[model samples]
Target: MTDKVTINIPVQYEAIAFKTKALGFDMPSDLQTGSLLKTLVASKPGGRILELGTGTGLATSWILSGMDNHASLVSVDNNELLINVAKEQLKDNRIEFICGDGYEWIAAYKGASFDLIFADAMPGKYDLFEETFALLKTGGIYFIDDMLPQPNWPEGHAQRVEAFITMLEKRTDLVLTPLNWSTGIIIVTKTSNKI
Candidate 1:
């Protein structure tokens, strides 16, 4: 027999995963990504966390699991149906769910900066790159996944991903590490207020 190691799954994960599948939602954060999100979140006690895509709250559950009681999370998604699944499954006083265009939300947001940002959607990651980055507190982590090629990617997406990596590489205000693991992750920490 072979030994196996399993990451701790959040309480709401199974239910959310079941519902996500029932609803035919194909894009949910994998376990590897979720584990990393949880670890990153635990680093910031009472931190303010932002999640740009609440896909069935799969990642949300993980983020919440790592958060202390005083920590708060704001999750946004444009799809009402998908986000509603998240809202229904994950009930925590620390979480605030917003159903609207992520790009619009980022543009209009005028609140305290976040300690960690998980940009799972296109708005904060591919669009409004500079604007969204400004919301991150210095030393705060900016995490993104799905960086490697995937089956769901559309035509020309690879080039776009390459371009995005190049752009991130040129930034001088932040330090970034591109991990080849877990759907390809890029963990960036803002080192200055230069934006």
Candidate 2:
């Protein structure tokens, strides 16, 4: 059995504190929120995965741990310092770490597709929703991790994010399920036949 996982506030916070102390890369998600990175990986075995953020490689480790040995992951982040840390922490051959702006990477990967896309980059920085949509294979999973909820959610902020969710829902090609977990997760599975 996979060893049980424990959540320690002190260690988790300390990890962020240590990384921030050594490298200035900002981290958007805390250890408490989001589906267990490990859980997602196990559920989507043998799936090609893409993660937009690799902060301190914490979640990176979780994803790698649960993924099938043959499945590959392309994890991206603009922070060289954080990426470097990830390199050492995540040494598995199945994972590729890239350092660059998420926008640039997403643009380049527009036509390419994957079985799963995990976005923990930032809260409202989800401006690339359309571009992201273009990169998912049919029956693929597009998961958005609410790194943080916009303060103006009530004042139309939620509307903007919700708009993206609404747009995806309108597409008969995809089955959408808004997962009501920590923070929030919008899980979209492509059901459309169109490429």
The top-ranked prediction according to TM-score is 1
lDDT of 2 by residue, 68-87 (tens): 87788999988787777778
The candidate maximizing lDDT is 1
lDDT of candidate 1 over 1-195, digit per residue (tens): 521216588988999999999999988999889989999999999999999999889999999999999999999999999999889988889999999999899999999999999999999999998999999999999999999999899999999999999999998999999999878999999999873
Assess each prediction's global lDDT (C-alpha) against the native: 0.93, 0.67
Clashing pairs in 2: 173-192
lDDT of candidate model 2 versus the reference: 0.67
After superposing candidate 1 on the true structure, give the runs of residues whose Cα lies further than 4 Å from its correct spot: 1-5
TM-scores across all candidates? 0.96, 0.74
Clashing pairs in 1: none
